[model samples]
Target: MEVDGNKFLNTGLLLVATILVAKLISAFIVPKSRKRLPPVVNGWPLIGGLPRFLKGPIFMLREEYPKLGSVFTVKLFHKNITFFIGPEVSAHFFKASESDLSQQEVYQFNVPTFGPGVVFDVDYSIRQEQFRFFTEALRVNKLKGYVNQMVVETEDYFSKWGSSGEVDLKYELEHLIILTASRCLLGREVRDKLFDDVSALFHDLDNGMLPISVLFPYLPIPAHKRRDKARQRLAEIFANIIASRKSANKSEDDMLQCFIDSKYKDGRPTTEAEVTGLLIAALFAGQHTSSITSTWTGAYLLCNKQYLSAVQEEQKNLMEKHGERVDHDILAEMDVLYRCIKEALRLHPPLIMLLRSSHSDFNVTTREGKEYDIPKGHIVATSPAFANRLPHIFKDPDRYDPDRFAVGREEDKVAGAFSYISFGGGRHGCLGEPFAYLQIKAIWTHLLRNFELELVSPFPEIDWNAMVVGVKGKVMVRYKRKELCVKQ
Candidate 1:
């Protein structure tokens, strides 16, 4: 043994070298191999981030975004909401199949509002079919007819404005949007005869979506009680209309008729309940969003004189070419006006956040190349309001610049598909996008053509209090009828 000391020393040195190599390998590889959850926002005991979230979800997201980076989570009571903040980290969020990221669970709150057996109440397959119905209802041909109705509604509504007067623009747009939506989507009966009653009921329905309602939709509260009543009454009203249409052997070119005429892939015609529910869903989706966007567009244009002049000039050129004819094609030609409205939506998207319940685990790599695993059962969310304002995505993101979307810049397309999600993108993108654009354009084009508008009130601030964020106070506007008239 003593004679073999050199061999023994060499063996000891080799063993030490192996030990050091193993340590180094583990130090480098083990951390890389472990599961990485998104950064979690630490909050109060048990209740977690609920209070801050309930106070201001967007503000909370904004505050946490800088600290947590693009992917992060905030616990609200028993729920863990993981946010995918930007386009780079959100492709799967927008594109995932229902089996991977299901919307039904996250949107169960809409059940009480949209009623049973339609939309959130139905399974994924049925929901897809229903969405198809919406898509068909808002097709280009259908939207052409809707554009005519929108123009008529806008003219009729604004014709009452005195030659020069001060008015609340927000109020005016809200009133007009409902009338147009009613005429186009709810049928002429609701528009001509029952506008006030139906609009009031919709008000009740809108008020029912209090923040707490998301968690306790069926709670025994006054708002919920009124909401249930409104739902029932709406069903009855629509049922009568459907019956009358069927019995009279009459049809109309509107979303109501479209829904009545719709059929599932299996060839099952929609029921009265289904029609009513779908109509309600359609109105709910468009009415407030259109109004909010319309107000923002006007507000932005009035505030930004250069953009306002650009849009007005576009209208002037359109009138010179079309001679006061404002059909779908003419409206389509008003690209300047379209960009203005789109920019407004980019700044103040009505639906601030979109959500999905993660049904299975998924990995997302962010723009910066950071990867994070979003676990099953987590509530996955993305914010259009936040993402649209990312400095990297849009130059001077906070400033109102419609030209950013103009041909040469096309900032929205610069970051690729989901860069501008004012109407969302991918699987659950808004089917009513064409309708929305046409509707807003119809209204704004009329205003620019027929009236000179000025923002009379201090520019309204974002009413963060609203479920659909919109102008906080009255957007008082002073308007005068234009003396120059182009033949219609």
Candidate 2:
């Protein structure tokens, strides 16, 4: 028995050795290069450029994009990622027709949180269909109700803060945005029942995007296990909701309800896994980005009192015009407010880079006629952070100028179609732009109108280590009750 066991162990070790050797060989050998791909900072030998890469969201692509010039490559783990910066090349990621660039393969890393068959995992066609359904369900008519919910929730949140001392806008917005998105996407019942689980899932999932384990997720890492558990908890919650909703023969007109009623291209109802996946996708996208933006917007308002005052004046004007109730039309008509939000997204976009995977070998020619034939399996990324800040696109790119988006402004038409890509670009762009706009605008409008924020610090420092950009110190501000405040 001992001899047989020893022989079996030896064979298993031999097989493992063979697989590792093959993988190492495959990683090292690049096919005959037609063009020289950009040189990268040296990193760990087997991991390539992973050692030098930023440990935060988009793995520090935000900082690297500027210094590395227009096109650069970095070997992460065993995989090589080529980042395309500026509006022109970045547009190729969003606008190329019949291209092999697909978001599914690259973004599938998110599946541990978003689940299989989710928007991030699916192709453009399915993503569009799911988005269309969400749009129909959460239409402009439906937005007023969501705004009302936001008002109520904001009121509750403020009551708890109660003319606060120091509050973590990060935690505050996380709770508020999740609560608000839950109300808008799942309605009150589901949001109430599953709120804690949803929050926990998002918290865990956000941690999962760390660059460390993303390169080797199955390696028995603590973050990996937590990520899996988070997904399991979220999936369990969604699964129970799906089963109950189906069993009760009831459906509400929220995003989840839309998924439940949806039929695939084959004209059959979506599977439970698909439904849960879609729900998770909607919640993840809807919640986090909006939360980050709202938090930043609030912080910027506190820091820039003039902009804050303008926002308050705009909100007051809208309230007066619409009799103190926030309507979709009222929110939409706040042109200056929209511009401020656009400027905020310009200054601090929720997502730093647009990620895609090359499905086949492709040639790219810069306008200057510099050409590179990129082979398949190379991860491709585009930066809206860079595109939105391109000097040619915006005259004073770094300035937070809302006038850039103001009505009939030259800045609106002064530059590239691909320049402003906060919601991303082309077919794979964010499906919830309108929904997100409404949610954020409503929250800010309510708060700005109802409160006065005094910033203690001159500026808040942004922590860019994770998927979402957050502040190191909670945005420290004193919120004076609106009822007691005089016009400044």
Candidate 3:
């Protein structure tokens, strides 16, 4: 009995020791696991704080800024995203080599839709070749013709409003912009009856960027299914368009034609699938960003009458100076209107975060004597939505002031390359930027000349789940025909 009691006591002691050791190890490791974060971090520990972030990415960012400081860490979906926000950090995104940090790692989820052969999926070498071809086709000379087409398309779209009682501007504008982009960038025939289905697919695929996919990329979830469907539909659409272009012997001027004519460094022609993916990438790149920005553009104008009048006056002078024609040269001279657009972008950039992942280990220094070692797989993001609103970058950061971008101001000198990243930066910078600018300018010029506009919705409340910074409810607007009491 004594021996058995002694054995039982030994076993109990061993169990107690094991539990104590585990408690000690956890206490030591948990705090150490949270050393100074890499350049940035999103939220607190296991709780993730995703609800806080989902409230409004931009708003959450604003709330976290003072609490977390310029650089901090947050966990979302068991993943760490470090945000190196502010103008200085934002500048690094433009200047940093694509080799040191890259977009592909962070945006890999898009591959299911964009395809493996797409420029967005390929290595820097292939992207270089593709971007060169894209730039040539979308350069100033090529854009002039497309800009004219965009203006005509805008007129037709607005005509649907018909001195309107009320209309959902966001929905109508997205359709208009995407259709015009498909026609001008892809090809006219590609913009036919098929786009209604294509647009629906794109919308569904865009909704797939949830925590589920971030956690399990291969799962047969709704997001994955929608992504797959969009990919197949897009591929089919592009295949038909390419076949039509070949059969008709169409001129190779549009972006689709550029893909058809491009040759890789080995002098091999791009495959049909390659051409299709490239076209889809271009279409996706152009449509949503412009639509979101334009919607905000209208919203901002409605809220601020003074700014709206200034834009209208500038448009009037531009039309009179250039005879109501939109060319690249005329676009250059619409300086005040451009400033207004810039101000709107500053206030509500289409994206809250410009995500990039470290391709290799990197080091960045904060204002303090602290340095962070960013690991190869670490996700890095910058919020132009935040950077553009920085008090140091803009004098009155929250105020919607176009004069901030007027001649000779520090805001005016906000480096077109990096500091102002409404279009993003680096080698991966948006190829459709120039064309997008011209399209927005043309739309504004045409509309401001013809209609008196007012907002019917209490200004848009942010929908953070949106691929772009989008609004939850529809933005309704009332448009009255301008009395020709004075011709613009």
Best by lDDT: 1
**Which should have the higher TM-score, number 2 or number 3?**
3
Judged by whole-model lDDT over C-alpha atoms, candidate 2 comes out at 0.71
lDDT of 1 at 417: 82
Residue 110's lDDT within candidate 2 is 75
Best by TM-score: 1
Return the candidate ranking by TM-score, descending: 1, 3, 2
Q: Where in model 1 is the C-alpha error above 4 Å?
A: 1-33, 486-488
C-alpha root-mean-square deviation, each candidate: 9.9, 6.2, 4.0
Model 1, clash count?
0
Tens-digit lDDT track of model 1 for 1-488: 87699899999999999999989988886675457888899899999998888788888987988888999999988889999988888899999999999999988998998989999999999999999999888888988999999988888888888889999999999999999999999999999899899999999999999988988999999999999999999999999999999999999999999999999999999999999999999998998899999999999999999999998888878777778788999888888888998999999999999999998988989877888988889999999999999999999999999999999899988788899999989999998888899999988888888888899799889999888888898999999888974423
Q: How many times do residue backbones clash in model 3?
A: 7
lDDT of 3 by residue, 45-143 (tens): 675767776665677778777776666666776666677766544556566788877876777766776676876689888888877878877878788
TM-score (all chains, Cα) for each model: 0.92, 0.83, 0.86
Error of 1 at 302 (Å): 0.8
- Ordered from best to worst lDDT, the candidate numbers read 1, 3, 2
Mind sharing the TM-score for model 2?
0.83
